[model samples]
Target: MLYHGPMAVYNELIGQGSLKEDDFQRTIIETLQDLHDRLMKYNPEPIVRDGKVAPEKERGFFSKLSKVFNKKEEERLAKEAEVARRAAIPKGLYLYGSVGTGKTMLMDLFYSSLERTDKKRVHFHNFMLQLHGRLHKLKTTTHQHEDPIPFLADSLAMESRILCLDEFQVTDIADAMLLRRLLEELVVVRGVVLVTTSNRHPTELYKNGIQRESFLPGIGVLEENCIVKCLDGGIDYRREKKTFFHSAKPKDRSKLASSSTMPTIVQDSSTILPDTLVDEKRFFWPLGPDTKKEIEMYFKSIRNGFQVTERRMNFLGRELVLPHTAGPIAMCSFDELCAKSLSAADYLTLAESFKVLILTGIPKLKPTTLHRNETRRLITLIDALYESQVKLICSADGPISEIFGGGSGAHSIDEDPSTMGQLTPAQRQMMDDLGLNDVSQVKKSPIFSGEEEKFAVQRAESRLIEMQGPGWGM
Candidate 1:
């Protein structure tokens, strides 16, 4: 008999037919494994790493924090401070690419394989919300003049030696402004290693924002510290076959919800099929009562309809109500998700509250005139789910490609070589060399009214199609 040990790496899962092997994914996984090994035996020497904020304060909170992270220098010279720092405190990994390029899967696999209980993984938006909440609480309770960041960093560093943050995008001005300071405090002052994933490159982050120049330093800091690598799997990994490992237990009903519009998964383990194995399409088109009925039937067939109603969620001093939710599943309408004043934080909360979201009535969202705000909100909501690996069930007005209102480019995930037929071979080669995710990243002029919104729709389109893949949600 073949000795099959416990699955750890992507290649192992690939050998078991549960994962598709990709070189890019393998490269990142190797880095993660290395990081894991180092962290298992590594202990940070008590010394402050150099940061932008080299305070001159000699006493009190700053002094205490300085003491906690302080290291002895060879001399007063800055060169000596640089030389005296301990053998690199294990650089963290930052993986970014187009949607459904196996970034999250790789991160999850790495996270699962880690034996360290000190490690914590979180979606970036939710993590920032938590930080903001902590900051706020400290501000209200602590000394007015005292800075909260030092205390916070010490607390966080104590909690986790390694922080694995997922879906690292810089959209919020508050987050953008605060990011560098917070990172300096954590990574430099207190020594918390960061493993992050993103769709946007660090340099491309917060592009075309109000006072964007201010955000540049944070991006620089991110690039300088983290080993930023792009994992472009060429094709959306979602389209691959979903398989159950006989070695592992069967996935919950929610994981079976690979797509919001997926075929109803047969409950019996033996009969369960991957996306390619089934003839039925994931999305329902040309909305009607029959479509609604079909969706309801799926709800019932999957796990009998909603087990509870109006599940209240409180986070960051806000209460969000999930209208109809069963265990690991929630049924939500377009209006509830997109039409309201829901922030990215709220969507993240919703994603965490349930493993599967049944999203209904997805009308055609245009970059130009129609439902721009709704389009933006829906895009954000999809991101939250996609990043969190939540299974999304979408009932829509159109196909995934055409969802952003039919235009010259239907937001085809730019990874497909056939999509760029017009580009010369050398130009394509240059693009590949440069690691451009898609045509959307290359546009010189706005194709529609909103350049940013246009980019967002393209990303959303990519994610929606990727979510339909059999390999998703699992």
Candidate 2:
């Protein structure tokens, strides 16, 4: 009950029977609605047509002069209004809760209710990826000594005064470092309001990360700049009973049934076969050549079923082949999918192609030997799939936490130099930029390698856990 305000839109929805009346959702919505109002108040620029002021229709020169004077006065008032709005911009809302608790639904409603066109609603991972790309571009194109974060933040502020980020978390040091700076610029300097949702509170974020002390400042910034509220929507909405249908007869009936006389079977017939005539549990047929052949063919076909099918496609000016896909599901090893040079566009295509993804052979991602590129790829893939509502079924060496934890060095980077060397040129450049030349160095500077990856893995782990629940994609 920390949030209290006139939630007009939320109340309207409850009255119209669109949203179920829940205290948790209502409080969060009321807070978000209030933030939305403040954001609108802070940005009072009216829409202009064709990027030019319309001339008055009056023919008199005096009228034109009067119109010009009025325009100047309006401009001054607008400037004053902007200054006042900046000072009065309400603290943004950070809604945290368990999975399927209507956090996203409320955020969506709040985002839609806002009148400002210069606002963005995106998953946090994707936003960080874009920011990283922009930083890289600025670093390569611009001269040294000019930090790109402020410039990038200014560009984003120009585009969107409010950022409604879903699943705000920090697992990676790179992202944590960048995020700390980015949030400072966006909130303090650019006056960009943030409305984000997360599963963890500010104090609990990146709890046991490597060099977590360095990342703790972002938590302070978040708590200071945003109103943190938890939505205790007890039950996960995605949890539902799944209906399963099983086959009545086995595909290889001869192995489990009597083969003396074949009974004529009719589709949809309800007649039960007599137990005395043929024992349902006894096997009478020997393993002949035909039966052996059938079994071999079955296993052989399954082995060859998911052949690596590739289609060349262009993503962000880089030519890459689409990963092997089969119907509404795709199966690939973690290395195959994440080790290669893939981008958000590729993941988007995969999400469009497959409703379910089965990724196997996911080694434990320890902070000591973290696969930076693979971890980043997995993060991007999860962001794309989560946004597209694709169900993920991954088989890792351990649970989500252990796989991405700092305790075990089971899958340390030192275990495989070939895998470490698989980083794309861009990724290698990024690592070099962070001053990480070898695994030993990365181990020493956990902040450089583990921070962003840790945060990203945490998010991916959360989404994976949520996808396993009953009503995930529904």
Candidate 3:
């Protein structure tokens, strides 16, 4: 019996009783197992290790001549195998489900089981950013007139024949339009396979938006090229822990002053206290048991002016240098933290690095202003902080509900020119790379503007409210 790939791993995990069994997950695993078997049969080089050709025996001249002919025959056989493998294109899988349905987990298992080297797994957003960058380069440099989609697809195929994309979504209209052509070229032309996970079904993607009709072709291509599997499960395993972090009710100012320790000044006047001291009152808010008045009094107790040493740390393959970090607390501007291409992994790193984080200047995430990337990053950051039990103190433009409002109106980029002006250089570069010529045309229709994102923002908003509760950080 030849058991390989995800099924084997699944079986092993089952035997160990490490994972609970799910019918949907098992179906996906079985499908992946079948694909793995076919890939092994067609692309035998990955499954079988070939030994070095044996040294020619020092015999007669005929023996030496035979070795040369044998070498040529072997080369021909290898070429034939390569051609056969290329002909056997694998049908990719697209797993879709609600949040925490084990789509990412299953995809990861399948990805790990693959033996091929020409495979890659990436977040869909990051992948799009890269694709746009490549497209921009192509447009500027070598191929101005030629269709760039096919070229980009061909380039991607060359780099990664099997692309395992997570959290696949088509939010931006530009991305939606490009995705159709890119998918068609990759699947129909280049024979590159795609295994992706999304919260919505193919038909439901890009649901309602300006010029959404143009995006339907991409949906058709996805349906034709990939096997769409829905992972059915109800429980959000991540939410099992109700109290992941401490919380406390607001207390009297006098009580707060007595209970909280005064900041101790080090011998060096420039050196701030190691734990949870904020230099700027405007940048920090004392949530939970500590009131603003209490915090101010504590600061006044420390006679010497204080400064914190900046430090740098690496997380998720990105270098983050903090301007202020002492003991278990760090502070930075919201844009400085989130304006760049930071992922959940970077947020996780921040959570691990600090007990409390003081973020300043969080703008309202209104539909009108529609700082999509920045808003998304904030949501991810909050999720990370909440899960990791990190306390958050921050200044925002408005209350949670007002900032992350729920409405059905379309979010136009042109609604707030001032907000657009505030976009970091990196954000501007991304827009430029994506060839976003007209903001008016890129309106996010109420229907197709991503319910998942809205839900995520709502969750983040709820978390923010919870963090401010008297019980928070207790």
Candidate 4:
């Protein structure tokens, strides 16, 4: 079975008879066997196994399939030519793909299969982050260098013949400039096999609106110098058959809501706390169960209507209302929510305002573990809100905490002193105040216990320094 990012794609592929079995691991093993069989005919000599074919003819199909991905016809020919050239004079390979389409997995398998003398794989994000830190150090003190890119590129070029980069998209201009120079100096001049994966289509990268066109010459260099391919498989290869995984679960009707443009008095049928008079001018309703219900109902209406907007959460219930920047903003507009593109800053800001946040789609991450990291980040965001005295209400297929709880990246209680030192004072206080100082407390409160105090102290120090501004880190 070939797995892609989406579980539905996997099911679709199985329905189409593209995959022989349902199990992802079994499918991977079978796929590797097929790839090895095909590649051996082309190499004759063991290109993979040090010029000697395996004695046992082991079925390592998945490994090879990952190594050599498919591209369009023209690009496929170009890649083949590049491969041939690299055989004579070994260089780097760059493997790239859309998000969650197995680009990293392929490279990982390839790196493992190669002899220790032959190859190495390094995730580009980790590599670049380290490089940036090193460069920061190099910039200070006595190590002023004329050509930082060349200096850094030379070091990376010499270290490994095969370099596989996961999540190889760049939105930062500083990174763009440095990456262009470093890749040119390392891959083209020094000969490094560069394998990368991205969420973007090749032509769409740095698309039309970007300022630095010169730095984007790397794309042309790739076109002229290497093979670039798209894994246009209909199947989503990431979803294994054994597990029932879906991108998102259906929303609950209990959370649905309704509202009108004019002033409206809403009253709870059972309890007579007060008749809430919703100010017509304000687009957002005050935090209430009815408001949440209204938002939910509105989402159902919009999804049914098929409307879309650039806004993350659309105010379908009213116009002339304050465009809410915070609070329990609900959605009746399905298309807008689904099509929304959120930035980290935006997310942080939204988190600051609202007690509860609901997102439908499950993001696909390479190595699979990063998904959990993001989940933790979201949970941290929730905790950030909880500190400000907010309640989080969410519904999912299972409990939100249990969804991906068992994975390697799952949040585990740490009893070690090291974990305690990592926390901020504010976080520690919040945890302790909420009785979240123990492992049991963590289950009750979103805050990390005891450990948060140190982190809080560090943050305070940093904030104080930042108030001075510019020269703070310096």
Candidate 1, residues 1-474, lDDT tens digits: the string is 532211354555566555666677778877887777777777775434312345775679876777666544323455665545434567788899875576766666666666676778777767888888888887888635687777777677777878888778766567877786778777765667888888778887877654568777777767767888998868765443352111111123223212333344433332232233233345777678988988887666555433656688876587667777776678888997798878888888788666678899988765444465687788889888876666677788877767877632243343356643354454356457755546544333232225556556666776676666553554
Model 2 off-target regions past 4 Å? 1-20, 44-86, 143-145, 208-217, 240-309, 313-335, 338-349, 352-380, 391-474
Which residue segments of model 3 deviate by more than 4 Å? 42-87, 242-308, 311-322, 325-374, 380-444, 447-452, 458-474
TM-score of 1: 0.71
Instruction: Flag regions of model 4 displaced more than 4 Å.
Output: 1-87, 90-98, 240-474
lDDT of 1 at 73: 37
Reference-based lDDT, residue 288, model 3? 32
lDDT of 4 by residue, 1-474 (tens): 743222333344346554334343334434433433333232211223112235865558896575456536658888897776545443233444333344444444443333334234443445666678667755674357454555565556555655656546554455666676776665665566565555455554544322447667776555544455554343334232222111110121111110111112212242111122322111223335665565565444323233333334322232212222232333222122222332333334444444323333332211122232344344333323322222223323332223333322333343344653354444456456644445443422223321222222222222222212211100
lDDT of 1 at 189: 54
Best to worst by lDDT, what's the order?
A: 1, 3, 2, 4
- Model 2 scores a TM of 0.56
For candidate 4, give the lDDT of residue 461.
24
